[model samples]
Target: MRQQIDGAVVLTAADEDVMEYLPNRGVFMAQLLGRDRGNAFGFYRGTMGPGCEISRELHTETTETIYILAGQALGIVGDREVPLGPGQMMHVETNVHHGLRNTGAGPLEFLVIGHPDF
Candidate 1:
């Protein structure tokens, strides 16, 4: 069934479907369920506060394309670092190490889309 959603509504997917995660480094407060658009892909929404960072990590199982919805972030992908702000998108393949950080002085809203039925 096709339904409409407002930013305020809650959604679920994985068993612990809640999207917000409070990490010691930053705030990940908003999460949106990725409605499958066919294939083995899904989406995840995350909100981070200023200085919030996604620790350096690699993906060996699932690949994802992350898009910045608001604010700005610094991404460390491989041996390079790049800055991305609202409306920017980056594609990351599996097995590559990459992470994101909210370098801006405000909260960052972004989405990370992944694939495969995990």
Candidate 2:
């Protein structure tokens, strides 16, 4: 099913059902847009439980951007470790090793966008 607004697709919580868990990462993602939606990039909502982390990895051809929605996070982007909070955004270039650790007492929520489909 699809939800649209002014001819544009809108993905809401109710429109998501499939949550993909990253192996051993304690991270879950719900894809909102990608090839299936005829989009050139992938859009997703991700959640990480407190004290959880996502291991460093790189997408050879994908540029990624993540915006924090709630809680705190430590982002490992390439050779730097950056602290992130709600309303903050991080951009990672293609082939850069990047990861995230939930540093808040509560769940860490964020939106992720990857170009060329993630």
Candidate 3:
């Protein structure tokens, strides 16, 4: 699963890819790029059902950049809560506690990019 065109790699919805869904977590994620592509950073597309949440946690070695694609989100960084929506983005530094909750009525879709291939 990868596509190479003119020395560039491209992965689209049309590509047959594997997506991981955790019912208990109410999350579905697709790794678009990472070790499988020999990339140093990881790129993923994730979705969470309404009312679902990812508990606060810290990544000691990985920095994460999240970009919302659709729906709304309530992002918790450290002790602060920030509201997010489509086209908005959030950056979480390494070792910082952060989490996200789907605050919209529908599914929350977003992109997550992490360094060091996490």
Which number leads on lDDT?
A: 2
Residue pairs in candidate 2 whose N, alpha carbon or C atoms collide under 3 angstroms: none
**Which number leads on TM-score?**
2
Residue 67 alpha-carbon offset, candidate 2, angstroms? 0.3
Residue-level error in angstroms, candidate 2, position 100: 0.6
Ranking by lDDT: 2, 3, 1
- The TM-scores, one per candidate, come to 0.72, 0.88, 0.87
What is the Å distance of residue 21 in model 3 from its true position? 5.8
Return whichever of 2 and 3 wins on lDDT.
2
Which 10 residues in a row give candidate 2 its minimum summed lDDT?
13-22
lDDT of 1 by residue, 60-110 (tens): 887878899899999889989999999999888989998888999889988
lDDT of each: 0.72, 0.86, 0.85
lDDT at 19 for candidate 1? 42
Rank the candidate models, highest TM-score first.
2, 3, 1
| Comparison by TM-score, 2 against 3, better one | 2
lDDT at residue 2 of model 3 (Cα atoms): 60
Query: On a 0 to 1 TM-score scale, where does candidate 2 land against the true structure?
Result: 0.88
